[model samples]
Target: MCAEPGHYKPLDAPVGPEPVAMVPVVQLYARDVPGLAFPAGTDLLQILWCPLVHEDDQYAANPRLLWRSTELTAAGTAAGEPPRPHTVEEDYLPRPCTVSPTAAVEYPNGDLPEELADLLDERFDDLKEKQGYCYFEVATTQQSKVGGYPGWTQPPDWPHCAGCGTRMEHLLSVTATEPGMGRWLPLDDRDPRQGISAAPSWQAEADPAALDTFGHDMCLGDLGGMYFFVCRACPGTPYTHRYDC
Candidate 1:
């Protein structure tokens, strides 16, 4: 009687179509800073979900429902909170003066292209032969959309001091004499090319040709061992010097 005879089949006849699991969806984004939420890592995908009955606009308002991955969530994304692990990998961009697959790569400025790197390598050797060691300042002539370079500008009087938060005029300048030496250093951690050294190396002499080209006065004996490698327009003024360091 409780089974209702032939009409009442098994209580789990169709097996309830198996419980559907809530599959986790992940999304990624290229953020200015790290941990910005993105929808599916730039590669889009479609997802099905049950909308709340109270939702006024269903498809139009919440057409694409995105889920965030733990890696991209800021303090777990419950509300407006700064993201965790705020270190984003740098994207390398190409420069107009350099030969690259594209016009630019999204990374720190001064990242020289392969072709330009080769030029610097040659210049480095050339400078080393004449001077004790070679130095260079890899930079772009273009103005940044975000304003001011990582620090300085190519033009002298163009307010290098303001945006960079330092008086660029006071900063010392260095240029790569070696061809390709200024390009991205090898991934080899053991190599000195991995990063720039803070202190200037006294391994080479100054190139007279570079002096003539840059036009800065060649004080071969500025401090006995300290000679300046500057341009004609950048003298007497102090600059926030940046080089391989």
Candidate 2:
């Protein structure tokens, strides 16, 4: 219940509950992502889970992907601090932030291809009648990304590869909606007089009592999203996940 967060100092295991531990949900590397295949000798890419509520992927939160070798993997080198889960599902806790690898340029938030989703829904209804917005709400993005396309709310189930069934790829998106408003926020948390529009203004341009410091607030159920998938031709890279609310 107290998962260490008052800025350090709190390690000394041993409690009643037998098995639970699995936090830390993201740790990429491979020189901060640029193509990502990572298997031959691995360069890190962890993820962890067990915060609870896992009636299997549809109920969400069960992660566990590892890809290691940036040191710590041969039975976790000399591992330590990672065993807090006596009781969780505090909406699947997650508040240990610090992963900033931005590199935009995404499209397809609906998982298209019904002939480009009816010609991009008539070019997004003529780009919402001459740019009032909505090219999938400014080029698709729901938050917490890596490789793209999965911010789907429901419809695209997309998980295949149970060891060579193929069709896996996606690889990330632990989103309960990051971008604290408007066009995917982050122009240094926006509001430099706020005018880089495309029909912006869902608010949170910054400091409205610190919009909960934007993202990873993890209430991931009514507002779900867990996505991860891999199987790079399987052989230790196997993985799968998909949640949507």
- Give all TM-scores, in the order shown: 0.17, 0.33
lDDT for each residue of candidate 1 in 70-111, tens digit (9 for 90 to 100): 454554547564222111111111111211111222232343
Candidate 2 lDDT tens digits, 1-245: 23322211113333334556668878888887877778898898888877765544365556678787876565656668655776566667787777555566787757766787676688788878996766766565777777878877777889899877869889788887775643465656655555546334433365555557756688677667888888777678788788888
Q: Cα miss at 233, model 2 (Å)? A: 16
lDDT comparing candidate 2 with the true structure: 0.69
Best by lDDT: 2
Q: Evaluate residue 57 in candidate 2 and report its C-alpha lDDT on the 0 to 100 scale.
A: 30
Candidate 2 pairs with clashing backbones: none
Candidate 2 deviant stretches above 4 angstroms: 1-23, 26-46, 49-110, 121-127, 138-141, 144-166, 169-172, 175-177, 181-209, 212-227, 230-245
Predicted candidate 2, C-alpha RMSD: 16.6
Task: Indicate which candidate wins on TM-score.
Answer: 2
Counting clashing residue pairs in each candidate, in order, gives 50, 0
